[model samples]
Target: MKFALTLVSGLLFNSIAQAGVGTELVADGFERPVWVGAPDSVKGKIWVMEQAGTVWIVDLKTGKKAEEPFLKIVPKVERKGNEQGLLGLAFAPDFAESGRYYVNYNEKGGETQIVRFVTEDGKTTDPDSGETIFQYDQPYANHNGGWLDFGPDGLLYVATGDGGSANDPKNLSQDLGSPLGKLLRLDVTGKEGYKPAEGNAFAGVDGALPEIHAFGLRNPWRCSFDAETGDFWIGDVGQNAWEEINVVKGNKTGGLNFGWRLREGDIKTPGRKGKEIGGKIPENYHAPIYVYAHGSGGTQGLSVTGGYVYRGSAVPDLKGRYIFADYQNPRIWSLREKGGKSTDFQDHTKALQPDGGRISLISSFGEDASGELYITDLTGPVYKIVEK
Candidate 1:
């Protein structure tokens, strides 16, 4: 493990020296844009994903959305619920040479599909060329944990939610047999359509699926790996009392069980009844790095929206801190990770919300090939992090 950290079950109350960072509008006029990113080989452009089944290419220099979408599969996509639709996209490591990319979307009958497509010119891809490499049925619509990306190891990592209901009705998070409620590692090549990524935790284990890398997640919203350190970071949305941020350091990559159903944030999940509602908490559960209480209203949490660690040249103060926020509350914050503890905690909410603009509904955060960070709010605006 490259890091060591304990879980924090309550709100951070430290008022330390602030990181001099803010956001500027990068592009606007998108429809429920859920993610934005670009391949390392590509520069000056980023692809934005709309939850309603569209991928748009935006020019960073012009700050304009592309006239035509890079990818569209709305007719095949089933976007009936709030959580279902085209949720993620990742360009292959060798995308510059191979022009291959992948997407994660929900099918008509509530199935999660991982499809691969080839782009001749790297600008657009034909839906006809897309092939579903992996698929699985989703029991419910709400907790469709749809986030996928290529890690530093060039393997595809996917986040999935537990069988969705209050307090994990089926307790799928702890079930080794199911792929639900787990982070999956997959390898994709020309010959092997889709298989377990090498060194996956359950590759040779009996009964468990080989694709599983880490298990026991409630609804991981948006996650990213530190471009510099390779450490994994995620914002796992909580059920009742809290919202959390979890980190698994770089060198150690598999066999992690983040307690859910049985544990939310750092405490036992408080369900409709009490903490006794879910099953037993494991002896050695991997706890969240940070947790915060619900935003006043008990109805929904300040749902966590995970973001990347800033490594761009523009912001020296925010150079190595992990920045993240919530959906319902939408207040952004940054904290330094040292010795497995969060220090130098700074609230970047006021600074990020520029000139009376609101980032009220954060869907996800993005990073381009240049290591700059961007935020995608469900409402339409995509903002870039800048020195303020």
Candidate 2:
């Protein structure tokens, strides 16, 4: 159920020769690796999320995967489509003491589930200990937006896609009552039901769902907070014509609307015939800081896989650049932003190429505990970003 988009021509072969950064194969042989993360407390261990409901622990020092899974919930996951399965994972801030973690996935009935689990000894999780934290029905399968990460404020932030189907037939992105197409911040520290964080934009709104932190996003494949500055970045997948990357300054409050059905990447998208809601567009719809068309030409990418801003010391040149990739086109780019504006952009796909060919089907990008970046390919391998 990967989002349906028009296929475009591949990147020019010459471009791969121009990349300045290279990638080293770190691990391979897994089923649809969607994400990779490491707990702050773990120095040399990394966890990789396979789309088919298993998390494998990898030892960075030896590059060997553990004999057993760190966590597995295949029985509860629905993997009938490409977009479903175990999509996200986050380690609690105090993971060393509590041995607790969270995950986002599609359950047996295609519903989105956010559940918490605790590892008794800090190595493996007891499958039976899963505590259901949140559940929501999805009308369509493709745009589930399953990405979750803890913000610098120490609250859980969840991203959900606009309730599926082409052209947003239901206009869910504009509906405050619906959790789809929005970013939600929750205080999950409590053992019972979660509560909206106190300073959330909609916390006290009359008819709005209090959990909402921001609205008007399509399928935000990945979003993350800068560990250094606390700024937020989201790579939002676009419809027929564009792909976008958006940011929320560290100081802004919630309730920022990124124009979706009303507009797509700064261009007005007329409502679909017979499904039009005819609502007035908001005056302050946030525009994407960077956008690329869907085509074979320069600066175009099929689907944007949002990544982290490099804060690691290994690659001095990429220190402050935001790294991202295109899932379909299999190209990587580093965006340099200063004072909330994009200052430079570079394509690094060629540098990441292995002897066989270019990295294909990059499903997601990940950050290790040290802030170094990694890219996961749907076929199997995960590569670490390195200086050429």
Candidate 3:
């Protein structure tokens, strides 16, 4: 049985020229931007992380962007080629007081590292407060997990891609010892820096990172917590055949292995070599709640760029919808469940990158203090998803 549902009464469709749900370009003039963070401590300001390692601060209320890049670590850091560099950021849940935050970036050696830093007087100049929270090696560049958020449980959850270079090599997705291809739960609120969150199912398990909450995933390109339910939605980009979205709710057992090399979507296969002899695997290794073919429509394909569950009041029609986009194309789609089966409800690509820019490559989607969705175009500008 497929667990999917469609919440909207009528689908809001669009074409290449025009969009339906009114997405006004709130900001522009970004250079190869990939991620955005709306830190509440900054008075509802949105911070954007550029591919070149600079963070741009945009004031949401004033429609003004800081003249100087908020923070620039790129000059010293190496971004050799694609799928690397600054990727994710989040303000500490208690940012108003501490003015502390975290960052996700890949080094010149192609390893993913999460670091904690404190801005000096709300400015990003000479950040002398840098602390290494955690670091993981990436075998390839493409699948470095791109988003981080503090869950309702107050644990910091970080997403790491399957050790990259196409096709899971180390099979880290199912290997508990590896942090690759998993959602990690870490206790960063302590004086000890980042430790495994207590009560994590694998915390005491030998040969494990103790921070892992779930495994068996491809590139979890983007993941976010549901506003109302606090459930997690991971858009794991698939290889060649299938794309999947996995749901992880709070306080559940820390081990739901979303099938990857063993099977793509719900299709059972013995191996990635394309053997189809497997009967039925354990239900424990679950399939996607929603799946799509690479040749679905529009671009006829979409690589996962996971986004937030809409909680913005501006778009009452999209209150609970999951908004996501593809990396190869400018097309954006919405997924909602109806009768336990998820369906693509709308296509809002026409309004995306409205300036007709190339390389729409959406690396991440962001949410403000008010819970509105903001998208970062890899080689473009940060856009706010507003109602039409």
Candidate 3 residue-wise lDDT, 183-236, digit = tens: 788889976478888887677788987888777777777788887888788888
Worst 10 residues of 2 by lDDT: 4-13
- Per-residue alpha-carbon lDDT of model 2 for 1-388, expressed as tens digits? 2331222223122233343567888889988899998988887778989988999999887888998899999999998766888999999899999888999999998999999999988778888789888888988777889899888888999999997887788888988899999999989888666888889988778889989988988899988888788889999998877888887778263888888877776567645555553344675677777777786554677788998988988888788888887888777877766666665677777777765756888888888888888889889988888877
User: Which wins on lDDT, candidate 1 or candidate 3?
Assistant: 1
Worst 10 residues of 1 by lDDT: 1-10
Runs with alpha carbons beyond 4 Å of true place in candidate 2: 1-20, 251-253, 270-281
Candidate 1, residues 296-364, lDDT tens digits: the string is 432224578888898878788788989887787667778777767667667777778866688888788
How do all models score by TM-score?
0.93, 0.93, 0.87
Hey, what RMSD does candidate 3 come out at? 4.4
Off by over 4 Å in 3: 1-20, 41-44, 250-253, 269-283, 338-340, 351-359
- Against the reference, the lDDT scores of all candidates come to 0.81, 0.81, 0.71
- Cα deviation of 245, candidate 3, in Å: 1.5
